[model samples]
Target: MLHFLPAPLRGLIGATLLALNTLACCVPLFSVTLLKICLPFPAAQRLCRWLMDFIHEAWISCNKVWMNLLGNTQWQVEGLQGLDYQHSYLVTSNHQSWVDILVLQYLLNRRVRPLKFFLKQELIWVPVIGLCWWALGFPFMKRYSKAYLAKHPEKKGKDLQTTRRTCAKFSQTSVGIFNFLEGTRHTPAKHAAQQSPFKHLLKPKAGGIAFVLDAMGEQLHSIVNVTIHYPQGNPGFWDILSGNVDEVVVRFKELPIPAEFIGRNYDQDEAYRLQFQQWVNQLWLEKDAELSELKQRFPGH
Candidate 1:
């Protein structure tokens, strides 16, 4: 029914429904988050987290419903076999558009533990959703650039210290840590600017995931490599909402974290850093080839 409507009308309706769903969830989510913040006791905090997870899962379910109702995208997802929700996972994927987050949530909802993203520290101030992210245990990272660190030499290892402290909390529960290895969305102009070695991807940044491994390496059960391909071209959020995107392919592959890579110094140890970079680059090469095959199989929208 939405497909027959004008694009603007479909977009309005879809956007309205999504906004309503978000508003509905955010109210209760914020309320519980406030309660969690005030309650300092461990048991009380655990209870609040459990309640927040229930609300968050419901929100994801509602968004999935909205996706089904408004979008006509064909989804081809694989490699979800043998996943256990009780185990912690480090999930890495290529970033294309904002819709990737929704797609991941739709696919990984109950298949694994709840997804927790490594958000920029500044995002914690973005109104209600920021608080929600905080209550849900997303690690907020304050990354310093090389130039900035050069100026303030004393603040050098502060970010890693923060990561270590935040990750320690995840040891109490099963969680899925998501990292976008490309660090930004892919665009033709941006890809050309980087002179990326991979035909379909930007250069993979190893530092963020490397920091995560250093912090939570012993606790993480496996690394989940997810490859997402937009067969109809990578669409914007509005395009997806308005039913413009036709197909999306998501493939998942779980690999073990090498023992040598765990608990290693990613910044100070040059040899370990080189080895880790090689491993991530190899994964990117494989993903780039996989994207090529997918494009060949699904040539056009």
Candidate 2:
């Protein structure tokens, strides 16, 4: 480990290494994406996705190398058994910090199907990396605010419709679709501002995961419920680069989606919507307790 180096220097080295890795991987990613579009055959498209996944994993593997060389952050993870790379999973987790994304990708890269996150529609236009995300089949979501929806009543359920369309394409292939249940990162200020009930989490948003299940519930093998706790406390992306992160605890459980939930219309059915909200609330309640326990049990080494 390069722990002896000054942290700012390590951070600069880490950033440069990761940027180079991403640029290296994006070239082949775009090439295969173009090949897939030109061919237009199912067989050819499948081949392109496979090739892209290989490239995607390689990029992540390179990041792992840089992470190992930069610092000595300990990873404590469990409940990864029985996961199949060939099966689709709805992976849900609590939001803490930007570091959560790195921890998830670092630990769960090849253990499950490649994770495709739901991105904001505007992100598609970002630049080189935006196209790389598109090439990897990340679903870009355009969300409408309540005020906008109220002004244009005709646009109701549009987000759900878009999700349904995107998920339909995923049905043909195995993927790990990830969503952060807490829409935003949790912080003491945010918790107090929102008057959140849970001690260690923000309010769990039901609409996001409900929409995912409504669209592709039957195709998904199970819900990969994940909890990530940083015993050193939540840290930003810079903390990772600066070698400040000491330890991370991750726990996962595979929960079966109820048969009745398959193909349910969340927007149209009021009763189902209430039931789903209750279910999500219960999950957040448990996760909050888990975080409380991890804090007590897993102090930093």
Candidate 3:
């Protein structure tokens, strides 16, 4: 049992197994991607997608096996009733540590569609994994800052145009899109520096989710709001692998995407932007309170 092993040995073993699992899955994924690229037919694309999904689900299954074998963490989860894997979803959560991604993958793996993240366009060049992500249909977003857009003038609406095209691709299949509304992981220093309005979260940015809703239109079924808490403290990935983190709490709440938000231009419409921001802020407020209660109930977790 990993409990009897030294912390260093536990971490080393867990890391090694995870690396091996990733490599095993990625090799076949790369091959399928090449095949999809070369064939460029609708049927071939669908076949490649099905194969990639199988490989990815197997990878997640392997990760779960390693977690149960190597980690001593207790999972407390709630609000997952009546989820349909075939439906499309827009999932948002509070970002605490890098380990949150693993937690989401573990909990939501077949309850909904496979989780796909919005990656920066530049990440597509990050070597082997980059092509794997592209092959798996992760949308690469090219965002132009306001200052840069001001200088270019002609490229102002380019980002949203790209988002619309990406959404069109996603409409062909059921998929779950993940957006970390805070845009970055949380830290005490960041919390203080931003003068954050919430007790436990950084300010939620409205633009990303707004664009997603507008781009996806009615194709997206519902919003899955997730709150992840580590009552012992936010643990790094190594802490989880080393059997140091004892408990993780995850809660899921599903809400309908308000009809008014669909097809509304977040960049051009002032009223819609304010209303969407207010809605997101309210969600953050509730999450902050829920986190406080979770920590209180599981003292010394």
Q: Give all candidate RMSDs, comma-separated.
A: 1.5, 1.2, 1.5
Model 2: weakest 10-residue lDDT segment is 239-248
Candidate 2: Cα lDDT at 90: 96
Query: What's the TM for model 1?
Result: 0.95
Tell me how far candidate 2 lies from the true structure as C-alpha RMSD in angstroms. 1.2
Cα deviation of 79 in candidate 3 (Å)? Answer: 0.9
> Where in model 1 is the C-alpha error above 4 Å?
none
Q: What's the lDDT of the predicted structure labeled candidate 3?
A: 0.88
lDDT of 3 by residue, 112-208 (tens): 8789888889999986668778888888888878899889999987767877777788878888989999988999999999999899999998888
lDDT per residue for candidate 2 within 1-301, as digits (tens), equals 8989999999999999988999999888888988998999989988988898899999988988988898898888889998888889999999999888888899889988779888889999997889888888888888888999899989898788888888888878888999998888988999999899999999988887799998889889999999999987789899887777888899999999988888888899999999999989999899999989988889755
Q: Which residue window of length 10 is worst by lDDT in model 3?
A: 157-166
Cand. 1 Cα-lDDT: 0.87
Positional deviation of residue 2's Cα in model 2 after best superposition, in angstroms: 1.1
lDDT per residue, candidate 1, 254-287, as tens digits? 9999999999999799999999999999999999
Q: Candidate 3: where are CA atoms >4 Å away?
A: 125-127
Which candidate should be chosen as best, given TM-score against the real structure?
A: 2
> TM-score of every model?
0.95, 0.97, 0.95
